[model samples]
Target chain A: MTLFFVVTLNGLTLAALYFLAASGFSLIFGLMRTVNMAHGALLLFGGYVGWSVVDATGLWALGVMAGGLAAALAGALVQIGVLGRMQGDELRQTLASIAISIILADLMLWIWGGTTYQVRTPSWLTGGTRIEVLGIGYATVRLYLMVFALSVGVGLWLFIQKTRIGAVIRAGVDDQDMLRALGYPINRIFVLVFAMGGMLAGMAGVIAGSALSIAPGTDLQFLLSSLVVVIVGGMGSVGGAALGALLIGLAEQYGLAYAPTYAAVVTFVIMVFVLAVRPQGLLGRAEA
Target chain B: MGTEALLRLSNINLHYGSSHVLHDVSLELSDRPLGILGRNGVGKTSICNAIFGLEPITSGTIMLGDQDLSKLTPEKRAQAGLGYVPQGRRIFRSLTVEEHLRILERKGGNWTTERVYQTFPRLKERRRNLGDRLSGGEQQMLAISRALLLNPQVLVLDEPTEGLAPAIVTDVVELINQVAQEGTSVLLVEQNLHAALAAVQDVAIIVGGEVVERVTAEALENDPKMQKQHLGLEAAGA
Candidate 1:
């Protein structure tokens, strides 16, 4: 019973991480129709920057803020420098972003070296106390991650539904040409959406690196997990991503607890099954 | 010029790369319903776009109430008293009818949510419906409502009654007339010559982007040869 609680808690933590990463990926793809391969690299880059800052200054929130701001800056630059010019070609965007990912990864290697390094957790989350859930004692930090993730989901839902710019974004995703005809600056909306997505991914990376420890090739791992979440959730869908992350996170935890060997394999199978059955995903709206 | 003419297009030409789409298209308008009629692909829509600066004229100028629109962006032109209801009822699918009205609202105007609802009461009923979910006629009403909220002096509607039910087309014509009655100049572009004749007083026929014939409906009714040569439609106003 205790083991069950532990696995479910682990699953929730994973879901929280997946939610942070996938929401931004889904949003960017939803409106811009651009698959940003550099998303993974940007995330790792954010983690390293945060870790380095915290290493130097010994300040936790400042590190997170600096890391997030830097990643957003990189995202803005990429949109202006590369994706802005490569409009109308999907293959070109994918290839260019992949090249950027490779370049950023190498750049990180030169700056921080190839050795795996652990991000120091803030003193607030340094120790865990007992918590009772379903008649089982569990670690407290993991519980906090679960709560934080749930809050992020709710906050994002409210943000997208309530704000004025959010209304424009929703309209833009439905039909960009129509938005342009209605006198909204569609390109500017795209920039704002992309920047927000990048920032969220950066924040997610920071939390995940602090919690689970970050390393070389961590970008690829984050990318793989996010991709799976997106596939399960459906592309261009935030609600779909959130639900998918939770399901996959729990599934992964149970798989890890029982099978151990089929940890990734179980989630992969579920994703494939969900995709083959409902091409648009469980909670996804139709693309058209 | 203030009270005499609301829209003045002079010697406007448009080209898409090497292909010329509009050639020396010129027209003058007052606060009256003006009809621009031509067969398919005669550059009637292109003329509307040029007048609203959606397409930059390679040559010539468009003056809307003393504001030059030759190089202005589409949104800028919209702000400069040029309201265009583009073809295909380009409504934002995600936005509800209310939200559509909210985005196009301008300050200091007779055009308001109340006025729009007064014009088309059906829209007030479907205020919560998304633009896409509406029927063809409802979409038309929403599109026109959005433009009206801009308080434009000149309203350019491209095929306002296309693919609509006969009854709805009547409603659309009545709405256009209402706007004209409110002292807004209407530029009606249509392939339905019969419907166009009922809606406006003046007609300009463009053949290959050049205004081959510009005349009043009474004069057009008298000239059968002009109709046969340019539009190939029988003059029925007589």
Candidate 2:
């Protein structure tokens, strides 16, 4: 029984991280129709920046903010400097973003070296709290991560569903030309959404890196996990990303507990199964 | 130079890459609705595109009220009080009816959400439905409603009544007349000669990318010989 609770908690924590990373990726791809290969690099870059900031200031919270803001700026720069000039050519966008990822990866290696680094969790989040009902002690930071993910999920849903700009974003995804014709500056909206997506990735990077060591190739791993989440949950939907993350997270945790050697293959198996049955992913519509 | 025409096109020439689409077309619209009629592939729609700045004119001037609109983008033209409902009822399929209206609302406009709902009660009933789920007539209504929300002085409707049921066509024709009666200068393009004759005050016919005939709708409506000569359609209007 205690083992079950532990696995479930682990699953939830992993799911939260996956949701954080995948939500932004799904949103950018869904709205802009651009496959941003640099998303993974952005996550790693954000983690490294957060580590350096904490090393300098000794304040974990400030590191998190700096990481998010820095990633947001980088995201806007990528869109403006590279993707914007591609003029809606998906193939060119993919190639350009892949080139950017390579450049970012090389830059990070030169700046931070190939050695692994992790953030020091602040004192406030380091301890564990006992759950009376489950008769187990859980790390407060992991529990907080779960709560944070849930809150972000709900907050994002509300922002997209209720706000005026949210309506414009939804409309823009369907027909960009129509949105422009309505007199809204679509370029600004694109930049804002791209920045927001990057901020989410950066925040996720900080929280996840604090729990695990981040190294040079860690970007590819997280990017693969996010791709799995997006594929399973359905692209371009906040709710879809959460649900996909939860399913993949549970499968991974359970696999780790039972079939440790095959754990890495479980997510791809599930993605393949889902795709065979439903080509549009779990929650995605057939057409945009 | 005289009183400002609502939408003025002078010596307009356009090309789709190297192929010329419109040649030296000029028009002046004031208070009444103007109808541009032509056979298929005669640049009637291109004229509307020119006025809204959707397709760049190769040479000539497009003036809206007192401002030159030859270089403005589509959105800027829309902000400058030009409304367009392009062909095929180009409604956003992902947005709901209410959302479509909300996205186009301008401050101090005579048209409000409440007024739009009242004007098209069917739209109010389907306010929560996505634009794709609505029937053709409903989509057309939503398109017009979206344009009306901008409170545009000049509204260009490209084939609003096309592919609709005969019954729905009557409803759309009535709606167009109602919009023009409310003092918004309308530029209507229609293949249906009877509907055009019935709804517009003035008519212009284009042949091979130029205006070959410009006359009052009443004059053209009465002249069956002229209609047969230009449109190649026998007297269809009663």
Candidate 3:
């Protein structure tokens, strides 16, 4: 029972990471319908940037800012220089993004080499003050992540519902042609949305790296996990994505606790089951 | 802006690939509804698209009052006093009816969300419903309301009464009449001759992608033979 609680707590932390990473994936997909295969690369690439900042400036806050800004800048440049010109052609966008991911992954390998690196949690987040919650003393970072994740989810919901820019974004997501017809410049909106998504991915990368050791093939793992979250949650639904992450996170925890051998396959099983039952995903509209 | 008429589209030519879809089509109009009538194969929707700058023309220009809209993008043209309600009531399925109105806001002495709701009381009742959740008539009403929020001097609506019930069609015709009364130039395309004659002042008939006949609604009612052959109907049968 104690093991179950601990494992569940750990899973929730992992889910939070997945939620942040996958929401960005959802936003970019929602707007342009372009599959950004380079998303996980942006995460891992952001982690390295954060790592470098911590090494130089020795401030965790500075590292976070640096990582986020770098990711946003890179995302904007990639969309404008590579993907923006590929509008109206879905196949070309997919091929171009996949090609860019391959090149970026290779470049990452060349620069960082095939070595595992641990992100040293800043002193502020390193140790947890003991707390007895139903006869279990878990790390404080787990609770912190949960609160932060919930805050982020709520903030995003409000931002999309309450702001003028948010109205335009939602409109764009529903019908890009109609929004453009209303005198909104869709190309500029595309760049801004993509950049915002990258900033989100970067934040997730920084937190995940600090919580767990970063590895050489972290990009592939992040990519696969993000894909699972996206599929389970529903492609264009932000609220669905968060719920999917939590369910998968909790399920993975239970699998790892009781059936350790089945932990790796838990997400895949849930995704397949959901797909079999409802192809449009948990909350998304059916494709016509 | 010239007071003679709100818009004058002169000698417009549109080609898709090597084939020309519109050949020297010119429409001159002011505050009254100009009904664009044609057979199915004729390019009625293409003309609307061309006027809204959704499709590029091979030659000629669309003048809305004083501004020349040929060089501008669709968005710029929309901002420059030209509004469009596309053939299909292209509402956003995920957004609520009110959200759709809010996103298409423009500054001028024009329609606001409240004013639009006042014009379309049905929209106010279905304000919170998602676009897909609304009925066809409601969707069409929202589309028109959204376009009106742009404060356009000239409004071009393509097939406004297509796929609507007779009663809803009457309501739409009434709305168009009310809009014309507000002094906005209206270009209406309709296949229903009875509805067009009831709702419009001037009418143009398109044949082989060009205006074959231009006349007043009274003239079209008078010449039943031309309506029979060109409009694909027999007036006596009706």
DockQ of each: 0.38, 0.54, 0.60
lDDT string for model 1 (B76-168, tens) is 777788778988888877678887787667677789988888878899999988888999999999989888888888899999999999899
Per-residue lDDT of B229 in model 3 = 81
Chain A TM-score of model 3 comes to: 0.95
**Which regions in candidate 2 have their CA more than 4 angstroms from the true location?**
A1-8, A127-138, A255-265, A272-277, B1-30, B38-70, B121-133, B163-168, B204-216, B219-238
Tell me which of candidates 1 and 3 scores higher on DockQ: 3
Can you give the lDDT of residue B116 in candidate 1?
85
CA deviation > 4 Å runs, candidate 1: A1-5, A56-59, A85-93, A129-131, A251-278, B1-32, B38-73, B133-135, B163-167, B181-183, B205-215, B218-238
TM-scores of the candidates are 0.82, 0.85, 0.88
Ranking by DockQ: 3, 2, 1
| Candidate 3, lDDT over the whole model | 0.82
Best candidate, lDDT: 2
Q: Mind giving the per-residue lDDT tens digits that candidate 2 earns over A1-288?
A: 898899999999999999988899988887888888889888888888989999999999888888888888899999988898884688999899999989999999999999989888889788898999999999988998899899989999888878888888888777777666666777788888889888888888887878666899987877888888988888878988999999999999989987999998998899999999987789887774
lDDT of 3 by residue, B1-238 (tens): 3338778889999999999999999989887779999888699988987887777899988888788988787778888887788888888887888888877766565799989888888899999898899998999999888888887777788887889999999998898888888888888887888878878899999988899998999989888898988998787328
Error of 3 at A286 (Å): 2.0
Which of the two candidates, 2 or 3, achieves a greater DockQ against the reference? Answer: 3
lDDT of each: 0.81, 0.86, 0.82
